[model samples]
Target: MKLFDFNKYFPDEKACRKAFKEMRDREGVVCQHCGSHDVVWLESKQQYQCKHCRHRTTLRSGTVMHGSKLPFMYWFIAMHLLTATKKSISAAELQRQLGHKRYQRLVTKQEHP
Candidate 1:
């Protein structure tokens, strides 16, 4: 998606989280610990609790952005940039576009994960 469309769709962290939850629900949330399909949404905790195992799964648990310190908006923008063009974007260029002083950490987390 284009930057404008991405921004329009995912305007903030809350929006991103809601969208992620909806997508996960649509696909069915399986418990990583017990491999059970029976899960409940814990709205207060913003996590999915496995009915069989009581294991909790966060929104980013299995996503590329899992464990990343950056905000969802940053990840969203990075995804847009990465897919927007035919040629791949350098981490440095991405950092510049992101206007973040420290790009190494973000790039490393995304690359390794």
Candidate 2:
């Protein structure tokens, strides 16, 4: 898809988050603490509560975005660019495209976790 279409599909942070949650739901969420698959989404808290253990897990807990402070849109955009592009794009180029002020933060977020 084109950049315009990508932007239209993910117009805001909420849209991106909702999309992520839908994908996660399809794959199913397993409780990290109790090792159970009985999890339900808590819309008010934006987390999953394990029915068996009562443990709360954030949407990003086991995903690529885990422990990262960047917005969901950033991850979506980065994924789109990385997969859609014919040529390999550098991290610096991605940072510039995202209009992020610091490259170190992006590198740290991508590399550390």
Candidate 3:
């Protein structure tokens, strides 16, 4: 999607989180700890609690941004830019477009994996 379309769909962190939660729920959240599909949404904690094992799976768990400090919006925007461009988008260009002073981690993440 274009930047405008992406912004329209996911305007903020909350929107992105909600979308992510809905997508995960639609796909069904399996308990990584016990291999069970009996999971409950813990809205307060923004995680999935495995009914069988009681293990909490975070919204970002098993996602590309799991351990990243950057916001979901950043990742979403980065994804859009990376895919929308006809030519390759370099990490430096992406960092510049993101207007982040310290974007080494974001760039490195995109590069390594």
Per-model TM-score versus the true fold: 0.82, 0.90, 0.84
Best by lDDT: 2
Q: What lDDT score goes with residue 3 in model 2?
A: 95
TM-score winner between 1 and 2, please give it. 2
Per-residue lDDT of candidate 3, residues 38-57 (tens digit)? 99998788889999889988
List where candidate 3 sits over 4 angstroms from the true fold: 107-113
* Candidate 1 residue runs with Cα over 4 Å from true position: 108-113
Cα miss at 91, model 1 (Å)? 1.2
Model 2 poorest ten-residue lDDT run: 104-113
lDDT accuracy of residue 66 in candidate 1: 72
lDDT of 3 at 47: 86
Candidate RMSDs in Å, in order, are 2.7, 2.1, 3.1
What C-alpha lDDT, on a 0 to 100 scale, does residue 99 get in candidate 3? 93
Q: lDDT, candidate 2, residue 112?
A: 36
lDDT of 1: 0.82
